[model samples]
Target chain A: RAHSNPFSDHQLEYPEKPADMDWSKLYPYYYDENTKEMTKKVTITDIGCGFGGLLIDLSPEFPNDLILGMEIRVQVTNYVEDRIIALRTNNVETKGYQNINVLRGNAMKFLPNFFEKGQLSKMFFCFPDPHFKQRKHKARIITNTLLSEYAYVLKEGGIIYTITDVEDLHIWMAKHLEEHPLFERLDETWESNDKCVQIMRHATEEGKKVERKKGDKFVACFKRLPTPEII
Target chain B: MSLIHPIQDIVSSEDGSLIFGIIKNEVVVFRVEEGKSQLVGKWVDELDRNEVIREKVEKEQARQIAENITKKRKTNDESAKTIESENKTAKIPTPGLGAPTVYSHLRNVTLSHGEKLLIICADSDKSVIIFDIDNDNKENVLQLKKRQPYPKRPNAIAISDDDKLIVIADKFGDVYTMSVDSDVKKIDGNVEPVLGHVSMLTSIVVVKDSENKKYIITADRDEHIKVTHYPQTYIVKHWLFGHNEFISSLSVPQWNKTNDLLLSAGGDRYLYLWNWGKNELLSKFNYEKLIDKYITDAHLASERFQNEENNLREYCVSKIVSLPSNRLVAFFVEATPLLIILKYSPEDNTLKLFQTMEFAFNIITMNVNNNQLLITLDNHESQNKDFIKILDFNENTDRFSTNESLSNNLDTTIASTLIEDKTSHIGSTGIYPLYTTINLKKHGESYS
Candidate 1:
């Protein structure tokens, strides 16, 4: 489906709080039963990661940090889940593809429910739903109110990466981040130096589709600023 | 059995001189002087569904009479008939959940702190109506002032500290702020929402920080509580993440001198206390032991879950009201007859169960007057005509006892006195969904 209502058709399960979340179920390699705790938490996230291309590509690049891809559609989430299982099964001897996983969730509504304050180091928005209608503008993934929530889960100096083929949506996403007080737009020099930005431009299934058509892919990045103290 | 409607909500003026009770679509007023009560004013919602239907019927009859008088003019009659029919079909129900239901009535009511303005949400037209309350004027106590309509029906409303800004959070997960005294903006254009949630917003309250900066604290049906900056609403604050189920109520107690302690509760068995300014869940106060018996069939989930292997039972924390000078906080569960009171321990910053009062019937709604509690009960089928109860906290005994004389006197007011009318029983689903909170529990399988 091209469009899914985030408000309805939602059967996602989340922890009461981040402390109660059982990350071992998602990343069994990191959980140690003797110590009864996971070695590390998920620090990188791919929001609306349609397919497992980005997760598969980032697994080897950042083997130490855990990466999670959150998708809302049922069939797409299932496809990503099966793809991860196959990748991990084929690389069992080397213990590869053990740091990446996919989960079904409406992240716009339940992001904070799964991640604690300042728990994430990076967030990605690659080829998200445009929701081009003026009336459906609030449904877009990037808004002033939702930016506040995204700021809550992201650590200070963390980076937010966005890429879209639709120029109008690119402008809309960039304008909202620029208007927010806690985020500053990263310049082209910083984007060129960043390795994740290079991997992101070609990893997603949507990016491949756009490349086949020889379409333009607009990219923008932002860095989260620290909260100011009250007088 | 004879049926009657119960009082759905209650509010009072700053002083204890006046009290208001909402029954169906009408707001009945009472004058509280000395220890006696007297009926003073009454205002019915103008946009009531039944009233609108009645007016349409009268208009159609008038049009028919006019057509009969002008039967010779076929062209004029045809044009007038077409216009009337068009008007009649204009209000056909929209096939969306956002559309107003048949049980359109006043849902939430409050009195502005500084100004004597009575603000209320009217569901019939998805508008907020404000009235100027003047006690000196004998002719009219509640005078009509302004009616501001929104794109969606408002679910919660909170006025800023300065009394200049009115924030309305609607059922469609959007929040809008408008000037308190401003008139008709609908003709100009639709006002965009300041911020929004993708879930049904249940309650909202405006609270200030240490430096006296105002922020809006909003909760939704998705078990989320969020705090956002006021003027720069786009600059999102951290979310208070704790509640396991839909959060139906949020209250920042006045006793918290610093104004940082926020109490929230919903379908969960525990009431959560949060230091909202710092984004910390302080503690969870369990009330299931006290309210376990109160959960009956009324607290069960919707009928769609009847065939499931296990029945899901839940209750919504309907109302939370704290006192002005004391540390006593009172709250009750929806469709339950128990009113559980808590005394905030300042030393530990925790809420301990102080006392529980069991009434003969379920409490419909309650409001704080000075330090007194004005409660209206669900008294539709019983022979007792006294539906209102007044209780005062006795400092010596550390318990709340009902005042017999005042309770009987208040019963004489219009809220308890019945006028003859033909409406369905209180048990009927026409006026209110008192127990709809249980439906907030998501029932379908994961990833459906």
Candidate 2:
């Protein structure tokens, strides 16, 4: 299945996974019990994953899970590919350099196209670009319209994790999630219990950057509510 | 067997030993160990619902009668003399008379300095109130004025360094500006044009250049840092683009011996340092670099290796600030609150991170004065109240330590340093004291 791609643009540019490529070694923190087995069978997609850090980080955590990072930038995708090779982690993979990938696409638009209803178990928007101004509000990654798409892709009780340093953005994200009928804010107990917070803080590239600056990081988790039972 | 607990409205004391408040308008207390509730004290006749409603109706009738009498009195001088006495008996719920309602859920705050006054932007009432902080009677000086309300909830506010203008940025991306001293009477002259941006303006800093020119440095949701110069106000002088996410906060160090440095933090978890004076980019660092440096260089060889891999690494930079001794501190939110202390060696264009400190929580805002470093943490853990930790830095020995608790939980996620006292404080001075006066009215409940 990896080789029959004559018409596909998804060919690896650098045929050789570089000697320095060692994804398993780079993100050993992700290689815990919970992730190791899940990765084997689960299909993970990272949305707006800049440089595929989360995917790279998760690869080790869930080494068997087929993880994919979707980014809009061709250069960023290439960089992640190089990073993946340098890290030399198997099972972690990438799609072609399309404008939209399972992870990198304008999720608001292509999410429903690629993912069937309740197809994804977890979706991560780590440090997504927040378009702040009133005029630019439409350009924000999370909106009333986009939340519906998230609802469509996410499975019942699926979770979405967001981390941002901007206080305003944090509140904005929370407001939207709280208002969304399909989602509910993760309870304090759940947030503390989940290993994703640790993964987000230490595994993803952005999480580490936040640690370096001592910048206040705002993290919000939302669970996709199960569809209401019919009367 | 399935056990179902009834949904109960239970209000407990801070210590959780005694139950407080009335249950269904009746004085009642709950016995926790017994898992039962019981009526406590008898309700006073005046406090009873029927008597209270009757009193309210009587007050309303009396107010109406007084209003009628006053109207008739105004029409005739003879009647006015009689109605003056009657009007004095009517007690109305006049505005700004009793204790002002307090708003508890304060999400964000901003300080705008005018010619002589400081304007406080708070989210609770969705109003901009002015305060004379320097006045002897600072407590009672906060006067709420009605300017144009924000189109949406405001997220941040910035006053030009000169203290002449104020800018309010909302969650929906509207930037409203008004003069600091503008009141109800001067509102027309105070209102300014809205500055349009591509995304919501998360944070703003009003900086002055070496030429004494003012520039509005704004970070927007679109991950763009805009340097808009004043006087012209037409063209954006330059746009700093690096972060692929939302810019959360902007910090401009006070005029230092070397030059003024502008630091920006964003959702991308990166801190960027820009020299606004030179209109040039300075340094960008992220958590990836920090962890990589630590994990790979546990033997201390990572620095030498990082020097080689610097060109290849993608780093997230969250915040930057100027330290006391011509150095800059960048804060990253990745692992711990890592403070990367950088010293500028003019010999090389690079800013070196000489020392680093680990903090407990993600730092949202930091203020450095003298040798004191005041850091505000983003309240990620709901269990912990948002707080500002003060750290004192010694340039001679190159050590940093906490001084005192400056302020705690001024806002929901982050706290800003409003005033810092530089004379006595070893690090930052004039820390903005938290104002806890706003009283929010309860619905048919006691004000307390």
**Clashing pairs in model 1, backbone N/Cα/C closer than 3 A:** A148-B236
Model 2 lDDT per residue over B1-448, tens place: 1111110112233222223221111122222223222222111111223343355567667766677777877676476556545544324443375664432223333333322343434343344544433323323322334333443556667776666667777664445676766654332212333444534557777666666667777776555576665644433455565654557667775535444677777555455667765656677655455645433221222233344645432233434556556555545442235666666555654556677776665444454544456565533353334444556666567677654332232221121211121211112212122211111101111111
- Please identify model 1 stretches exceeding 4 Å from their true place: A1-3, A28-37, A92-95, A187-195, A229-231, B1-4, B48-101, B186-192, B307-312, B347-349, B415-431, B445-447
What's the residue-level lDDT of B20 in candidate 1?
76
Q: Which runs of model 2 end up more than 4 angstroms from their true locations?
A: A1-231, B1-118, B138-148, B184-192, B255-261, B276-279, B291-319, B334-337, B360-365, B376-388, B404-448
By DockQ, who's the top model here? 1
Error of 2 at A216 (Å): 56
Cα lDDT tens digits for candidate 1, A47-100: 988888999999999999999999988799899999999999999999999999
**Best prediction by TM-score:** 1
- TM-scores vs. true structure, each candidate: 0.85, 0.40
- How does the DockQ of candidate 1 come out? 0.34
Please give, for residues B78-175, the per-residue lDDT of candidate 1 as tens digits. Answer: 56555444433324333486665567578788888874888889887788888888888786688888888776789999998777788999887888
- Per-residue lDDT of A116-212 in model 2, one digit per residue for the tens? 4566788888887776654455556665535655765677888888888888888988987897667899877888888877787677677788889
- Across the candidates, what are chain A's individual TM-scores? 0.98, 0.73
Cα lDDT, all candidates: 0.81, 0.51
